[model samples]
Target: MLDIIYKYQNLLANIDEYIEDSKFKKEYLIEQLGVSRATFYNKVKKKSFTIDEMVVLSTILFPEEAKAFEIKEALRQSREDSKAGKTRDHKDVMAEVRDKLRA
Candidate 1:
């Protein structure tokens, strides 16, 4: 759960960086994401977003950053799997994460 919370915060920070670097307004971003202002705010506040929603936002907002984010997420998941005593290949987990990111 803490990992998820951290991931959520990191994702938000990445979005903020993109917005700042590109001088892109949040309103425009929300529009591009097809999410209303209120809905966007609510999702951020609740930290409740589906992977598909996140992929859409990342792909639209900062495609380059999305690659970095996917790599980080894959690493984190791999660590978690190891911690849980799940015997799985890190490469396999990374492949799965990559597949999802591509989707």
Candidate 2:
């Protein structure tokens, strides 16, 4: 959806600014990511982090925003699945949930 696209674009465009403005210390972030400081700086400068690295860093630096993005992405995917008739019936879903809760 447009919201997901807009958020993705904003994240891609402002990742560097986000890193710079994060409350976490760069050294701590580097340590948490298990990357050398130089490598971290290089990646930030080049915007060349791997998807795994980006996911970890984003979760650490912007937990709320990362969660929001994930929820939006899930909703978008759910909409697509619904349009494709890939969704289970609501009664079936509720039954499954109740079964799990009982277990």
Candidate 3:
């Protein structure tokens, strides 16, 4: 278990290095990320990625694209909230979401 976790950590670190060194290519990097081929294809077939995946990929493969996606803006907001120790009440957020959906 420890070995597997260590390997994964090393893999993630190498990915970071590749991103910084501009050596990451889509196919290669995606493979190197160590997700299963099925997962990769499913994500591709779905034509969408989770926010965390988007953040990592865009922040690496193309920061300009990330900026355009407003990831930086969202991160900035998160940072500000952290600094101020502010947090959204989940119930409030959920109620707003429900209200917006109803509208």
Ranking by lDDT: 2, 1, 3
lDDT of 3 by residue, 37-90 (tens): 677656656544555664566576765765776877898999999899898899
lDDT of 2 by residue, 68-97 (tens): 989999999999999999979889999999
TM-score of each: 0.41, 0.57, 0.34
Best by TM-score: 2
Q: Which candidate, 1 or 3, would have the higher lDDT against the true structure?
A: 1
Name the best candidate (by lDDT). 2
As for lDDT, the candidate ahead, 1 or 2, is 2
Q: How many collisions per candidate?
A: 0, 0, 0
Consecutive 10-residue window with the lowest summed lDDT within model 2? 4-13
lDDT of each: 0.76, 0.86, 0.66
Ranking of all candidate structures by their TM-score, best first: 2, 1, 3
Which window of ten consecutive residues has the lowest lDDT sum in model 3? 11-20
